[model samples]
Structures are given as structure tokens and as C-alpha cells.
Target: MWYLRRFLLRQPRSHALCPTSPSSSHAPSSSLPSSPLQCRTLSSTGGAGFYNFPPSAHYDLIVIGSGPAAQKCAIDSVKRGRRVAMIDKNSQMGGVCVHTGTIPSKTFREAVLHLTGYRHQGFYGKSTFTSSRRSSMNEILQRVQKVEDVEAEVTRHQMRRNGVHLVTGTARFLENGANDAHVKLAVLLTDPEQERKGIYKHREASLPKTLLTAEKVMIACGTRPVRQEETVFDGKRVFDSDQLLWGGIDRVPRSFIVVGAGVIGIEYASMINVLPGTNVTIIDPRPNLLGFADREVVDALMYSMRHYGARFVLGEKVGYPALASTSMEQGRRASCHMWGDFEAIPEHSMAAEQGGEVKSVLQQGGFLGRDTERLFPYGIYTIPEISMIGKTEEQLTAEKVPYEVGIANYKELAKGQMLGGMDGFLKLIFSTEDFRILGVHAIGEGATEIVHIGQVVMAAGGSVHYFVDAVFNFPTLAEAYNVAAHNGLKNMGINV
Candidate 1:
């Protein structure tokens, strides 16, 4: 292990590199100090193949991260007989995925699944179980820690095994005055003394200024939880997705307004739903979750979520419009905000959902920043990847329409896991308060085709009982129809 010690001192002058704090510190740059300042360095004894080099070290390649991507890149270069070094400000070897994102989120899912017994919950009629065992935040997090520690250790072992040196400090690029092609910009590492003491500390009292120049630089720095300017993430009551799964959180909230319906949003909402005494309300402007997947898959997911006591506010904003009206002009038919210059034909009427900036009427739709609805200034998509057309449960609920959903999971299907895809579900929403099929929504490996099953049934004016009565091909996600029909019936107080 390379003990990256803290640089105890810096030359008393303005420096170029941005400051590196344990929190919220990005890279900064400044010219090297004219004179050296007192610093400290220390390393644990018995470090295999231990070596120390001043900050003036140069390498063939400098990777500015220690995540899976960085680790692989560094190791590959080393195998090709290239000298490579990796840098990371977070004292841990693994990046955000292992520490916060995928690893912890999946781990949290397992804990919730086991504690809630969600798969078989449908066998019981009610959303809540009086006999259900409740798990504490401490207990759940303790389980997550064991998994995280093992993953981190594996990552550290990989780096050491491959001889990829790790520099634990904030790294930023130095300005290249000459703009030389052979020698790229130098990288400056600003490590605080207190920071070094916490992690692997160096043995020397003074840490040499590290200014590394490399032939090439690769920025493998992964992502962090986005803390938008609109919301105040206090981390106690409010948290970004990353902070919620991290161990720093003290308690699981009794109630929460989880924003977004994307993968993270849906996964978290589902996980939280299984927790005892917890109510989860998911909000998103989209009409449904995993809208592009098969309607059946999404429907199945929604059924599971609702059965677990979760609520969704879909295609609706909580508060405020995107841009308010300054003055209502009689010349235009609708009250709208005009961003581009258009000849306003006097009294021309225009409805919303056309993506036009003008608000023709005082309709109940608008952006509420972070606390309200999502306001997208611009978002672009071009290929024909996947598409769907359906109404959400929120819409049905608001309209006082009677409907039931048949649900299925991709994992339940053998060959259709890809079609039922990972983290995907198939749902059939029908007017089946003993009425016709309403719509099918799905998101899964088999979403595209699975949805067609419900669509065909809906088109034929068949009720969900069709699924209950029919025998589907085995080892197929289509069989989810059987399970979902059973679940829908259970929810409606029907024994069959």
C-alpha cells in the first residue's frame, strides 16, 4: 500500500490548483511555488515494494480516478510496459459505484426484499402485514457494510496485484504555457495534512510538492449524486440518491417524496415501500415509469409498487408553472411565454402538449423547480429505441375510472429475462372492474413484445380474466400474465 501522506505546508503565495477538501473540493491550478515550504510525509512499515518519489514525478500515463474504469486502464497500460499512476481524492480505493451507487443500492434491495418478503406479499390481501418483522436502519446498513467492504478489498487487491500506483489526493491539470505536444499539462495534487492522517499517512514530516507531468492524461472520475441548486439537501430529512444509500444516513424516513421515475427512482421507491410503517410517494412528470418498455412490464412494476403501499403522482407537477405570465395580452388566444419571435395572429388559440412555450389557458401543468415539477429547458433524443402509449394510474385515479392491473416480473421468465429485461416488469391495465382492457405498460428485457399481449387482449375487449383462464407458453415472460392476473384479483378482494 502506498501511504499517500499529507503535505503539511505550502509556499506562502497564491497557488494555481483548486483546494482539495474532504467534501466539495474540485481541482485548482497555480504555478509552482518559487521556494519550498515545510511539509510532512509518513508510510506504514512493511509496505511491499515501497518506494517514495517527490511530487515532481512524471509518468507515461496519469489516470485521475481509481474506479473500475481507471483501475482497468492503468493495469492495461502497465501490462504494455508503460508506467501508470492513478489518483483519487476519496481515501478509499474503489469509486462511487462500490461505495454508493450500484453496490449499495442492490444490497439495500436484497435486505428490503428479505425483510418485506415482497415476492409472496401478494398472497396476502393487505398492503401491510401486522406480523411482518421490522428492520432498523442500523441493522440494514450493517448488512450493506459487509458487502461494501468485501468489494472494496477486491478492488484494492486488483490495483496492488497489477502494480498500479494509487495517489490519494485532489488532482488538477497545470497550465501549459508553451502548449507543448510531447509533454502534456502537469497535474498538481493538493492534499491536506489532516486528510493524510485519516487514510494511509506518510512517514516523513514534510511532504514534497507533487507536480506530475505526463505524456497522456485520462480523466476517469465517475459521477456524484447531483445536488441541484433548487433543493436543499440537508442529508437528514432530504438526501440525493447517493446519500440515502450511504451509511451516513441516521434513519429511514417514515414518509418521503421520492422524485424521479427513472431506474434509481423506481428502485428506491420499491425498496422503501417494503419497509414497515414507511410511506413512499413517487413523483415524475412522465406519464409512467419505464414508459418505453412493454406496457405490460411497467404495469406489473406498478402493481407490485402499489401492492407494497407506494403511491405515484404521474404526468402532474406539484407546484408552479414554468414561466409565469407578466401581462395577459388579448392579442393571443392562450396565455403563453414566447421564447422565439412569432407573428402573433390576433386571437389564435393553441393548446398545450405541443411543446410550445405559450400557456394558452390556466391548465393545471407547470414546472415546480426541484420541489415541484421538473423543468427541462432542453432535452434531446433521436433514435427509435423504444416507445409506448398509455395512461398512468394517477390519470385513472384522477378521472375516477375503474381499472385493474395484471403484473409480472422478468426474473419469473426463463428465456425472457432479456425481453423481461433486468429490473423490468410487465403490466396490463384494463377496465376490468369486470370491464375491457385499458392499456398495457412494460419495461423489461421482454417489454417490447410482452406489451403486445395485453394490447391484443385490450383490443379484443377481453377482461383480465382472459389471463386467469388461458394457459401461456412456459419459460416465457408472457406467463407473467398469469401471476399478474392473480395479483390484480387479490387486490380487488376476489379469491380467484
Candidate 2:
């Protein structure tokens, strides 16, 4: 990683990938220079491996998928003056993060919080809002769309201004052309949805596929909620996280069963459970949730969520939807459209023999999957968000690393009290001997933002004393670090 960063810095922008366009597909370019390979291996060099697409169509770096990972890589490459082209199946750019997943879910949470007076309940009560007994699904969706629109536009503009050729279509790897020196891939330029609906912009829509080769291709197509092949997606009763936004959810369901206890599942459970008339029961195969966070923090979050009427059925594995019902149609007829992990909700006390088709849906994805080895942060937006980094106490203990824990509750901080975030808290774990920061965990407002303070210090080899001596503005959540430092040092028998 360090070597790659240094190399990128040394490479001149003139040697960047040449952004391709509609015309480039029709007539490949012949402008590639045969400069010294330097360190440009098949993986790093615009893809001198097996793909055998037209040389003129070759880009310096081809980033597939417009999600965060792809976006960052593309931007970095283009800033170096590389010809970069980014492609996605969605008509609107930004992939799932902006279009259907993160942006929509978080915005939905905010909308639910504001519309139902969830945050304002401390002072004005739930009745502080209008006389509506239940929140309309349309109202929640409006906020999500508005946010997604702005974010997607920003992403597209960011790529365009940086000279990234934006291709709206689906991308697929062709052959492992071992004999070829370039990496070749295929793209369907027509919108996927339009093709599905048999709606064509013109007679040429039916044949929108383009085969282009690149020096290097980055597969950033973020994973979607993987519903089983047999599972039916009526869009109303059954849906994935992406579909959950479009017609993912109709209204705040009276009750929904979330199959996975990963970040997304818990987040959706937390947000929807707070609605006027909604209930959520989250099921996970793991006994403990958020295995990466501090035990105390996860415990607190679970307790709060339970108090809010969200049920957690941990250590329970979901049966296959096929085994639960004789046929897919029968499963859908149960009122709850079956998909993903839920073979049956028998574990949930709220489950009944019949509901025809459950108004609720299943959460079909997680940060970690046994099938893949990708690592990413898990941020669950449950009112007060939860974020963590580095090793947890459990992981360290299992590995026999000595560690200590220090906690600062939001209730004990003036800032938390000021903003009615008494429910929030920060947990800092540092080595016992030197008090060097190990991991920082927080569950409360701006927790996602707070973890970075500890991360920066830890990366710099700073210890607990760094936080204690450092002065933060009074009445700010960042000051929680000060509190954590005081508690940690005090435990170590040091006087303030």
C-alpha cells in the first residue's frame, strides 16, 4: 500500500488513463505510448494481461461501479491525469451508496426522526407533531429522494470535472484473454431498467453493448442484498435494501422481521421501529452483535433498542425460504414475502401461523460474508449511530493481548446533556502498561465522527495522556475524549 501511494505521487499526470467517450467506442484510439514499464505489472499497468479489446478503446484505468470504493479510486487516478472511465448499471451515478443504500437509508432515518418527532420527544412528547397516528411512507420517501438527487448529482459532477468519462450501463468481464496484453470488458450503455421494461430510447437500444479494453480494471460493483434465486421480488411485500427504497417499503410496517443482525439490518430495525406504529424483530446467527465494537457499547445499544420495542433473536440461524414453504408462491401468499435468510420467523414471538403476506421485508446483506474477503467499516444509523475501528476487546483477549477499557457516557458530558444525547457514550481501549490507544468505540450522536480523533492519535503512536493534555472546546462531544482519558488514567492510579 505504501509503495503504491508513493508511486502514484511520482507518476506524471500526462501518463494517466485517457477518458473514453461514445465516439471512442465506435473508433478505438491509437494514442497509447510504449514507455518504460517502470513498475506497471499486469495488475497495475492499464491491464496488459489477457483482455483483448481494441487498443484505442483502452483506458489507463477502468473503474467499474460508482460506489464509494470505485469513486475514490477513479478520482485518485484521474487527478493524476490518467484517462479514467467509470461505469455503472444505474441510470443515476454513485452506485448503491448514493442511489439506493446508504444515502436513502440514512435520509429515511432522519426523515422518520423529524417527521414523527422522535428527537423532539424529550421535551414536547410524541404528540408534538400533527395528529397523524401513522407516518405516510410517501413522506419518508420524499426526503430520501431529495437527498439522493443532490448526492448523485454531486458525484456525477465530481467525476465530470475531473475528466472521468461517465458511462451509464452494466459492465461485465469478458474472457481471461491470457494471450492479450490488455484487459477487455463489456458494457451495456442502455439503462438496465429501460431494457427490462421494453422501453427503448430508439431502435438501437436493443443493441447497446460495447466491448472495450483497459490497461487496468477495478471491479467496484458493490454487492447488493443477495436474495435467493427462488425468492420472488414483487417489490411490495418482498425486497432487498436497494429495492426497499424504490418500492423497498410501502409504509412503516406494523411489524417486520430482519434476518441479519449486521449493520444494515440493525440500522433499519432501529429506524423503522421508532415510527408511529412499527415493530421490528432482528435475527442473527451470531450470539453477540457488533462483534467489532466494545462489549459495553454493544450491550448499551442492545438495551436501548430493546427499550424502544426492537427485539433481537441472537444465535439463531434462519432456515432457507424453500424449506419453510413448499413453494415460493405459498411463501409469498403468507402475507410476508419470503426471501434471503428467513425460512421461518418461528423464533420471533410475534410470528403467527398466518399473515398471508407480511407487510415487512427481510434485510439481506452484511459487511462480512464468508464468500468474500473484503473489509469495510460498519455504521448502523440507529438514532444515535454506532461506529468502531481497529481490534475489539474480544479480539484482543482471544489473541492474548493485554488491554484496558475506559468509558465516558454522554449523560456525564455537558454537550450530551445540552443536545439531549444522554443515551450516547464513548469507550476507549488502550494498553494497560503504556496507556497507548488501542481502539475507540462510541455509541451516540456523532459517534461516526468521533472515532477518527482516536484513530489519528493511535496511528501516530499517541497514548492516553494525549487526550488528557489536549484541550477540546467546552461543551463539545469531542471533549468526551478528555473524560475518557481522565477515567483511564484514574484507573491506572494516576492523579488528575
* Predicted structure with the largest TM-score when compared to the true one: 2
lDDT of candidate 2 over 1-496, digit per residue (tens): 0000000001111111223333443433455433211121233243232122223355777776676656666776665556777776555777656765567888988888888776666566666673566888789889898999888899899878887777655555555435668776656555444645635342233434556667777654543444456555555555445555774455666766666665666666677777766676776777888675678778888888777788888897656453322111111111111211122221111121111012111111112223222122335577668877667888889989888777898889888877765488888888987878888888888888888888778777899889989999988999999998899778878888
Model 1 per-residue lDDT at 340: 10
TM-score list, all predictions: 0.54, 0.74
Clashes of 2: 22
**Overall local distance difference test of candidate 2:** 0.61
Q: What 10-residue stretch in candidate 1 is worst by lDDT? A: 1-10
What is the Å distance of residue 118 in model 1 from its true position? 3.1
Ten contiguous residues with the weakest lDDT in model 2: 1-10
* Model 1 C-alpha lDDT versus the unseen true structure: 0.51
Candidate 2 at 448: error in angstroms?
Answer: 1.2
lDDT of each: 0.51, 0.61
The TM-score that candidate 1 achieves is 0.54
